[model samples]
Target chain A: MKLVGIAGTIEDHSYNRTLLKFMANHFSDQVDIEVLDIQDVPLFNQSDDQTDGAPVQYLKRKIEGADGVILATPEHNHTTTAAMKSVLEWLSFKIHPLAGKPVMIVGASYFDQGSSRAQLNLRQILESPGVDANVFPGNEFLLGNVRDAFDDQNNLKDDKTISFLSSTLKKFLTFVTTINDMNAKVAAADWESEDLGAHGHVDTTIDGLDMHAADWVDQATKKTNAVSGDTYVRLDCGVLTVDQLNYFLNSMPMELTYVDANNQFLYYNHQTDPENMSAKRAPAQVGNPIEDCHPKRAIPHVKQAVHILRSGQTDLFKLPVPSDGSKADMHYYQAMHDKDGNYAGINEFVLDILPIVKYYLGLTGQKLVKDPNATDALTGASKKSDDAKPDDVSGASANTDEAPAEKPAEEPKPDVDSVSGASANN
Target chain B: MQKFIAMVGTNSTNSTNRKLLTYIQRHFADKAEIELMEIKDLPLFNKPEDRKVPAVVTEMANKIDAADGVIISTPEYDHSAPAALMNALEWLSFHITPFIDKPVMIVGASYGALGTSRAQEHLRQILDAPELRARIMPSSEYFLAHSLQAFDDDGNLVDEQNIKKLDGLFADFQIFVKISDQLKNAHGANYEEVRNLDWNK
Candidate 1:
């Protein structure tokens, strides 16, 4: 059970590195762990190889000699520290010390989720071709609310959390033995294989240019020599000019969008400017891959919704876009099929149904009242998973700015010029 | 025309991410005024006991405070943002809150196919932190994969599609900047919260 530990941060004072030191001493009876420092590991650059550098050599020799390694990472910008990543880059480049080594991940953060994202990212990086290491699976050694996790003696204070950590490490010792004995090559996870970039080509895909290009409309038009202006175009139901088709689609009550079968955002109705529209759509956003039009956090949900519609699991998937106000927006994703019953694309339409409901009530001369048995979650607004809602992110400081408590000031503000002088007055 | 601060999020002497930012600046010359900033000089953030921010960081913060918007082009290292960029952010969010409520656009370039996908995602979370609170442009990303081959001899972007993507994103970013001004309801509360932050607690 010989192991080497490296904290993901090079900060002068880091809870993650301290957590590693605690684990090494506390679990000395069960396992032998040596803590390493990344204080002098410079930022990684391919042109500036630090393989022969003293700092890198120190860790490389130790990692190569160890049976397993434990990475206690700190979450920075939702991932492992750049210092830790730099160390990995040097080790993986021209020297594969981490290759085939057993690795376990643990992390601590100021808030909850204790570096969850960073640990996942580290696993991905460690399993990469360059730094191919076998990572222990399933156990999530998360130490959240880490500021108070330790006492003055530098030992973990929580009995439950400490017991959990002890058990997780015990499992890790077993994981190391099993992995080292079998040396099995596991298949990639289900989620890892799916590419959201939408790079795969179908028959209608335009290959010459990037699908995310800003001028895709003009370029695609030129490439295809598409008819425009008053040019006549034959439709399935009738014949009309290009201008007439545009006028017809734009005049629709709901904002329309077309996402092709290949997951490309091919078209959207832009009758009004972005500021006025219920859902903003820029002309330049017309030909982007679907993922580009949404924040990274929403990608998983986007893929799920598309899959349900694409796989013939459902003909229509409706979502209520949440809003605090009475703007009860509704979004519908209707599946469009080709003549032969093949899934072609989605015809998504967005509209505020509140007006329609109001109109109905007015016509009927009726009043509106809340139902006591109604579930709020079922009818909640702001449900568009693709939308970038700030609430979705963990805003840790949302409430901390309230009236300061009467406790003594932690760090005297003699640091620099006052940043929020006006805030004090308010 | 809008004014912007374009930050090269890496310290490497030879970085395609820097080249990407340069391309954005030159390509959008007619639409906006763009000034490129480097994070290389800022030291790695160690949370000095004095709580004093470095002079260079203060200079950068002042520039960011004055700009209408910011464009950050990052290079992915080991599936996350480079330490140099994160180090710079650590200082920016420490005491000076220039990023607070400022309009920001995230773009990236990579030597491989993923194009810094994870790093941009990670950066989004960091910018969303209470201390930073940057109003990142919604629903848009510009990932320049195979960046080494993405540019020409004059540093102009070689691929027309990537050029268009950057163009579209920049155009959207301008609109986003204007809209950010309307989201001032939380401005006061945001500053107050940041000022009272005690990370040690």
Candidate 2:
């Protein structure tokens, strides 16, 4: 298969770049791979897409010609780099070369655990409607402690790593070949002349075989109806079922633990991914007395907060939890009340506010841009499903407000110095 | 050799509080046998059912029972110790009472300016409860603030003041444990007399 390997970093000596190069060279016998340089791809601007640039056209043509795309990405602040997102934005708006294209993602990081989060995020982006890249499921090639994993020649040194990468490549190749063969069979099938069932409709026959599309649709509709029935509770914003409320709670970056007014540990949201969660809640802690949840040493303080909230002295209490310096830890306790303003429960929000704190403090070298097409310009690579519709593309557009702009064009040292100086007085 | 078990409060893999315990173990290498205990595996304390005791809890109790003294290096979360550490303590307090009359020292490392002063005070209150009846070292409270910067890459305490304070605290703890052990062994009514003796001089 002819593949286009996109190194998702612009750094001159990026490990991700070297990793892609190594993959291209090592897998030369099995697949024809060409590494695409994204350094000269101008920052994504929706207004300028109508007047295509040479580099943009070059990237689009290369992607169009390739049978599969390989993304080797570097993570920044627990997400994919801004540079990688910019490339996706430029490609997604117009031609949508990624749509129905076979893609695979891999990443390397200096930490003991590689860039798994970034790879997950990238898969989400690729699967989104506009991109619609057929990302391989459950295959992650994370080269951790990458500096030590590779040799002086930019080749992977460890036999185990090389074997793992080789196996993953083989699996990806099989997946691509299978998809291509299936598509070819479906295309060659004469569906027009196929028998129409009793309803005088196409019988959902594919390649002279029954697809059972009707049964699948019926089951899906029934499941959706069953899930949405009378399980909803009215909220200020809208009606939400217990499952929906849990989804909203878990969707938040923070972990939440709730204690009722009677000082009972009521509930905690089950984290979707335990590895990514900073705080873990065991099931046994639920239904226990709130006082019992805390160490005896901290019981008095827990009581005081409850008492204060019960007495209507304060509605909220906030504290910054100490961290090991990698992330900022903040805790917020809000007094929950009933419609009659009676104290109902206490809700605790444990958040890693380092990103927000750093952003405001200007400690982060992230750039901010103001553009009308900003929303469409950068979409989260997440929120894609295997059957995602083409029209479902708009929903995945990332909120421009949340996307950190590309890093400043110049050196970052001076910016850090000035920002630190400004923050010193605060 | 006097064996001391150190329990760190937080379950974070990158916990600075755990790093502080490692620093303590290194600093007091010649003084006592400091065993760094992990509370991550201990199930949450539940009544009646947990009273029968899981094998893991039984093992934890056994270790505590064998140890001469206990050291707790904690990080304050929501102005208290994390749930994992508390759960372990509750298990011990309920089933074993191993902390009763045990010489326990509390030290904390935090990212905040106050370190874990509030948590230490709260812990002291808990240890002094009638059922637990732990004899805590009251002379000094080692609260390391900005703990991320307190240690070097090699896990050694970098600040001279912190190093000096830890040195004194460990020495005082050793003396405290020795006296406490002597008092525990003292025959029937002699405990009152032994407790009144001026060990400071």
Candidate 3:
């Protein structure tokens, strides 16, 4: 499980921060806990919205990607510090990354009360309609007289305290799973709201053009004065000409397609004839809404897949194609996110993994057989398997995770790259 | 006339709470010499080891000390008073005792129908803390709900009932201020007690 630790204090030295650091190091094996710094976050003033600012956006993206969040707070007055409150205000205002996200509160204090009042105050604030964070119940880890709580290397000296913290974290993880599962089930029916008509306009949605037009790609390229051929385009890590970019993408083994955040089918690697491709996508289908590109029967499934991806429920949705008992084709719908982790769109790719499986089996001298424990594995299934890193979903989008923040990450422009993750293909 | 400092809670450029305070200052002009102060300019409190307050905070404390009472007009954000106001209060109580034994009236305005009701309660608890120990007027709450529509073209409160309630509260606060001053037997002891507390030490 991945979690992010937010040390509520922006101070140079704080016991609260120390507590979080100790938790991160001690429980390093149990979870991926990245300690986020809040010093750069400006105070929340509705008059001055720094919501789109780098510091706040960084925290948002980090929290969005995390399975759960741990907030280590210090007491100021009888409540959480103003810095912590300010951060919460920013998170809740305009952008709600904490909404429906599971959060755990831990605190430390110089007094005997050990930030008791502050934690309660934090709970109240988090439960407000705007924040709406699912705070864990009944586990208050308050480190009192925190001055003597730690040793030379900042490790907690008390074994009893350490063991309690361990148990609390384990319980909190279980709570996180339960809450996420509940949210998925409850929100599953709400996916019908996904507007596949491309009615909503993004910044890149070209104006005064029919999205359903077969000549959309040609018209859009001309209207935008888009570069082509030897025109050099600067990428995140390298500079490549438009022709070079095409050559690289077209050489990819898997048939790839790009549907933008607005649900507009924008591009496909037209490497071969439509009949010869693994996924039969034509060049004329470019710039159509995803609804226009798929059959009526597939609309509901498409909407659900895109909805889960867009909502950050999961990063990637994969399903097996029911082929004529020959081709073991798999369709992967990977949710793309900007550097700030906003859902950009879907990077749908189809590839027959049979060749790779056969090659692996031949090299390893192993035979393909069903396990005795397997009850329903004869036909192609979703396979909710991220146990082993499924790194074989190859494409230019694999590099999108590392997209530079200097430019708009979700922009349909060639330089933009975004986030992607995996979910079972319900 | 009793002098009272009206502290506007939020740092937002446009706030109905500030409008409410402005209306109160003018509406109760003859009743009390109300001076408006903003918590916006004060820096966020980080609990410095030296325990020295900023110059702006000291200035605020001086004004509060000079005033006979304080009337805080607050706005709710995430079901609590804005952090800017909380930050100012933190600095005030960190080293100085501006609010100790001082008469305080908590009033709030909100765009929503709740009128910052929960936040006013929260502020009451904060002021009642040992570090603050403010003498808040009891059995009194004047929250202007749907405050956006409560004001008129001239910025006067449009509702006659709200005006009547505010007038009665202002009178009560004046009386409460005089009564609070007479109840200062433990003020000196409380100051010493607060000063000697094992804080940040």
Candidate with the greatest lDDT versus the true structure: 3
lDDT of 3 by residue, A150-197 (tens): 999999999999999999999999999999878767775677888888
Tens-digit per-residue lDDT, A1-426, candidate 1: 799999987778899989999999999999999999989988776767788889998999899768899999987655677678878888887788887789999999998889998888888888877788989998999999998999998899999999999999999999888876554223111323334577887778877987878999999999989899899998899999999999999899999999888888888878889888766789998889887877677665566556656654456755666677578776767779998568888898889898887876655455567668655453422233224232232110111112123353443333222343424432
Pairs with backbone N, CA or C atoms under 3 Å apart (clashes), candidate 1? A214-B164, A214-B165, A321-A382, A322-A381, A322-A382, A322-A383, A323-A382
lDDT of 3 at A237: 100
Give per-residue CA lDDT, model 3, range B68-105, as digits (tens). 99999989999998888888898899878999999999
Instruction: Give model 1's share of reference contacts.
Output: 0.39
lDDT of 2 by residue, A145-235 (tens): 8878888888999988899999999999998887656643443232222111211222221122222232432343454443443488888
Better of 2 and 3 by lDDT: 3
Instruction: Single out the weakest 10-residue window by summed lDDT for candidate 1 chain B.
Output: B41-50
In order, the Cα lDDT scores of the candidates are 0.80, 0.67, 0.84
Worst 10 residues of 2 chain A by lDDT: A394-403
List iRMS (one decimal) for every candidate: 2.4, 22.7, 1.2
In model 1, state the lDDT of residue B111: 87
True C-alpha contacts between chains kept, each model in order: 0.39, 0.00, 0.62
Q: How many backbone clashes does candidate 2 have?
A: 6
